[model samples]
Target: MKNIFILAFLSVAIFSCGPGSKTIGDTSSSEIATNDTIKIANEALEYEVIIVEPGFDSWLISQPPRGYYGQTKLESKNRQFVAEYNTRVLNPTKYSRNLYTEQINYDAAVDYGYEVNYLLYNYFMYFQEKYNEKFIGGRN
Candidate 1:
């Protein structure tokens, strides 16, 4: 039983070393996974990246969900987002690629990628403040 107790104690100690309950890849709080690639929510057309670009994430977080913006605004914004995002994926050598997968998969980030919204949002804010730069494009 001593082994079990040691394991439990070590687990708690390891987990407690961070800011708090916030763990890597965990967006329930403010922690963000630096190694994040890309995650498509439900494997469908709606998705959000953890932290890849600055300008893009900034623009994305500014708006609301499907019903949040008017049809015209939503379409215009979505188009802009898609265009900028595509530019990033098209250039894999860039560092923004760190924000998501290496392939040109825009579908996963659309509509904030569903469940990853909260996590992405937190990452965005933290990234922007910490980096002192935008997170929109790879070159930028």
Candidate 2:
């Protein structure tokens, strides 16, 4: 009886700790890449692409609050391109502004890689139309 119990416990423990057993805070590289691609593509399509981090917020937060923030990743010929975008409140002092950021990733070999900039542009346009009175701006 003792031997059987030990064997059963060991078997359970081994099987429970298999390859698919992910920790609580485990973030995969694939997920990160995908997110990066989406962000880059979205930003590229909507607003001008600024490689600098500080510039990211500036572009999004304009004088009168025109656009929002976004980001994405792109895989081209085994290379990766991370895209980002943001909306700026043209006149932050005068009006309240909301800031947002997003991103996506795709396989380098795949022709249909994700475009974060385009997605961001569409998202910003949608929100701009939805909330015409409210202006948004911030750094990300």
Candidate 3:
């Protein structure tokens, strides 16, 4: 089981960081806010996509190409990301939630995209009760 998990993580990391991979937004020492958006290369395509969120700079730095075959452990993120996304989006139920749906297509946004969206969405939602900025468009 562990080997399978490791193999899967290796595959995602390899494919993600390959030729089409892109690192965006907080690539620097400084951090970005919830409303900031940046364009980055797509993992499966040649074109770039926009990601509107924050905190990704530090999060990505902590992850690895050190897990499973010296690659990012992206495979482990889906279950967690999906769960958080579903909860934040207020899905009718766990089974009804689909991360790849047209409205919240995480695959098109890519793993990093999905991750940042989840983070931004939850952050904005948590803060909107006190702050009125209403960052509504960044979610996956």
Candidate 4:
């Protein structure tokens, strides 16, 4: 009788303390730390991309490579540049939302002509300031 009771009690206790059990005071600091790390990494990536945009534009402009024969290659390249620039600027993420689609489109329109110099200049300045503020800790 006693043996039977002890066996039953032990089985119940073991089953109740199985892997899926969580005590009342259980809290996960590792999960919080992981989330923080992800946030920082994503921010760093954004800053890097923004900082690179002006240099990319300048490289594209200075290439002077031939485009498709017979067609207006400059216009086509400018369009591609605008699309890539917009996509880079509007990188999807949890923290930053893209609210400047129209601005990019407008800038693309202006870039189709020879007016992109000013826009590119401003973008470079903005990117530099933002990059320094976010990643470089305002050092540069």
The lDDT leader among the candidates is 1
Clashing pairs in 4: none
Question: Lowest summed lDDT over 10 consecutive residues: which window, candidate 3?
Answer: 64-73
Badly placed stretches (over 4 Å) of model 3 are 1-38, 43-49, 62-73, 91-103, 107-140
lDDT of 1 by residue, 1-140 (tens): 99999999999999889776755445632222332334434546443343444344445555454454344443444444445555666777764566534443444334543244444444434544555635453214
Candidates arranged by TM-score, highest first: 1, 3, 2, 4
Query: lDDT score, residue 46, model 2?
Result: 44
- On the 0 to 100 scale, the lDDT of residue 61 in model 3 is 46
Residue-by-residue lDDT tens digits, candidate 4, 1-140: 99999999999999888677677545476643443221111243232112223234444444333331223443454455455555655664522344323224433333233333333333433444544422222114
Q: For model 1, give the 10-residue run with minimal summed lDDT.
A: 28-37
Compared with the true structure, what per-residue lDDT tens digits does model 3 show for residues 1-140? 99999999999998888556446632443435433455556557444545444554344444332332211323234334444554556744542333223233445334454444444334334334333423334223
- Cα RMSD, each candidate: 10.7, 14.7, 22.7, 16.9
How close is every model to the real structure, measured as TM-score? 0.32, 0.24, 0.28, 0.24
TM-score, candidate 4, is 0.24
Give the winner by lDDT: 3 or 4.
3
Instruction: Assess candidate 2 and give its TM-score to the true structure.
Output: 0.24
Error of 2 at 107 (Å): 27
94, model 1: CA deviation in Å? 3.3
- Go through the candidates in order and give each one's C-alpha lDDT: 0.48, 0.39, 0.44, 0.41
Q: What pairs collide in candidate 3?
A: 65-71
